[model samples]
Target: MVLSDLGRRINAAVSDLSRAPNLDEKAFDSMIKEICAALLSADVNVKLVGNLRKSIREQVKFKDLPPNTNNNTKRRLIQQAVFDHLTHLVDPHAEPYKPKKGKSNVIMFVGLQGAGKTTTCTKLARYYQTRGFKACLVCADTFRAGAYDQLKQNATKAKIPYYGSLTETDPAVVAAAGVARFRKEKFEIIIVDTSGRHQQEADLFAEMVQVQTAIKPDQTIMVLDGTIGQAVESQSTAFKQTADFGAIIITKTDGGAAGGGAISAVAATHTPIIFLGTGEHMMDLERFEPKAFISRLLGYGDMSGLIDHIQSITRDSAAMKETQKHLAEGIFTLRDMKEQITNIMKMGPLSKVAGMIPGLGGMMGGMSDADGTEKLKRMIYIYDSMTAKELESDGKILVEQPTRMTRIAHGSGTSVREVEELLTQHKVMAGIAKNMGQNKQNMQRAQKMMQGPNSKQQAAAMQKRLQSMGGAGRGMPGMGGDLSQMMQMMGQGGGGMPNMAQMQQMMSQMGGGGLGGLGNMFGGGGGGGRGRGR
Candidate 1:
């Protein structure tokens, strides 16, 4: 079973138990049985699955629950147990070494051949570089022909500085030379890519040791292929004994059916998984957080991950600042919407971003990245075709002047209906902005309360509010109702911004109409006229 299939099976089991008319111990056991079966099919270790099953049974204690307990309370306990146990299955409880800003941090990569160590080196370098670190890569894989060239190519494409020597035959010598040169130049993060073997060969271990000795690296990471499944446990254990790597990065997770097995196997050895290479793109590396990973796997979404991605890609552009100012003032213009759409494009694949939203991921259904991108392009085109005055307005002017809509549609090569759809989407977001603006005083008070002596109480109250709003199956199809509720919550000083549930609902609305209107315009079927551009 693939990761998505495994998640679906497990989620279905839980949902089935939640909806069971009896909600008895028998139903709980049945759910556990189904989850274990799903995990086993995904190549997770039998011993690990058994332990999980036992842990869940112990945690829930369904038989001991008070007879007076409501079904909702029982469901929450069971769900929490499954979530916590799954998180524990992947968490090593060991913190990986973090590089200091001013100091040189040498990170060495080691793994079996074809585990994607070379490409991952560039991805890691780019990750640190984007975070204000002067990061570089050094190729020390003398065993593999063209290893240096591959690293050179990847580095060049990512625009990261790299060091490699075709003339050097000694891996350790090349590694030491690269580290010395970068350290002298004050590079903050120096990542060394080492050679891998077909198996855990003696020669490979010896070479890894030599490179480790030469660089005295602050951290050594073992890159594992997620497709290898249960075999990763033995492979990782052998490498741990020989190379003593401090962290692990599982690559090829995006398509691996045994990704769950790989993660659980690595965790069994007590090494932290620093990242998961989700795709071939340099930007596909995801920071590993156990809770977030399991949440996303179970289709619960990862709000923190979404926030981090937003923060990572968000720039201090004048346009963005102006939009933020407008949002604060309860004003959202077409220009503001354009800036946001552009940012969404930068956030990465629509599928990935949609997955981060609690309910929107599944709602995306069959929309491909190409389709989503094309739709967004059309929206941008519509904006571009507009006059400067129209762009700056709150979309009311275009609504009042129906001819302006027809003109924009013709100029952008889209139908007038698409233009109207864009305006409708703008209206939704504008209403959100207006509500936010009206609750500016409440937001200020809430911020002050968070900083005050009773901050903990205020924070708890706010969390309670979010939890109440985040009930399962609450938003989807009828996003406007949810958006209104979210705005009302904000107005009541429940943390001025939308919570994860609200954001999911808002995204659903956007996906359904604003961002999602592509289906209608392109004849995929949402009841809007087809575009001329099509």
Candidate 2:
């Protein structure tokens, strides 16, 4: 089974347990057996399969339950046990060395030729650069003819500092020169990309060793191709034995059916996986969080991961802040709508974003099939069809004038109904943004510590501030008056946004898909989007 299918199978196994009328040994054992099969089929090691299965069964059998032990509690225990074991199987519990700013920290990359070593190096550099670290790249792969050119192109595009030479044939010479140059230039994180032979050639290995010894890098990361599956174990071991690799990165996971196998294989080697390359884009790299990965894998959303990805995009902190301020007062313009859509696009595909959420992870593939992206593309064109004045103020002109909507549809080659749908969607998003802004501001105030005479005084002061802030809390966006209510709504599945089906119906009644994604992306968090370059 593919990794995606494996997750469904595992989830189905658990879901079956949850639906059982009685938590009898027969049913529980059946669930365990099904899960074991799914994991083993996904290229997870046999030993891990056996261990997790035994552990889950033992926990259930040995549990200290009262005479009236309920099925819900029993099911939860089994689920938790399974979640914990899977996490343990992945995390090596080893902390890799992190580069501190203002000092040169060299990191070396080693892997087979097709493991995407060069691109991974660029992604790593981009990751650090966006996070305020001065990072540069060095191409030391003299074995490959285009290695230097590829690195140069990637670095130039990302605007990251790079050092390499066309005439340098020896990788060690290039490595030494690149390291010295970047260090002199005060680059904090310097990454050196080494060559990877097709079949682990002895000469290439010796060259890698030579480069490593010459550079004396702070960390040596082994890049493993997830498509190779069980072979990753031997490859990981070889790299570790060669250079004492500090971490591992699994690439091509976006296309690799054996991604799970590679992860499990690396775990068996006791090497910590630092990241997963989820797609072809430079920003497709994601930091590996065991709980988040497992949560998403088992059909639970990784809300934290989703939030972080949203934050990474959405440039212009001041503009975002201004937008939020205006939105809090229930003000949203067509231009603001454009900005939000652009930010979402920058964050990548909608399905990828959906997979990061807790409830939507399981339906990622289906969501992709829902033609939501085509709808989004239409929305973007509709946005592009708007005039400057139409975008600046409220969309009152477009709403008041049907001719304008018709003009937009004609211009964008879309139906007039789509334009109206986009408008109505904007209204819903504005409402949510307003609530989110107010709620976030109120919450920040509540979380503050006041210098007061007593606890009662502070409590009264907080209440007064909340009251002053208009604690109406009805349809409040983001984290507001009742977190439980928001979670309850989320559990009902619209991802705390207005139900998509209902939104579509509303759109059909008047004519909206652009703003539906906005609520889930920013409505809950109301991030300041501070500490980033605007």
Q: Against the true structure, whose TM-score is highest?
A: 1
Query: What lDDT does candidate 2 reach at residue 9?
Result: 88
Please list all clashing residue pairs in model 1, or write none if there are none: none
Report, for all candidates in order, the number of backbone clashes: 0, 6
Clashing residue pairs in candidate 2 are 301-357, 301-358, 420-511, 421-511, 421-512, 478-524
The candidate scoring highest on lDDT is 1
lDDT of model 2, residue 176: 97
lDDT of 2 by residue, 150-193 (tens): 99999998888888888979999999999999889989999999
Worst 10 residues of 1 by lDDT: 471-480
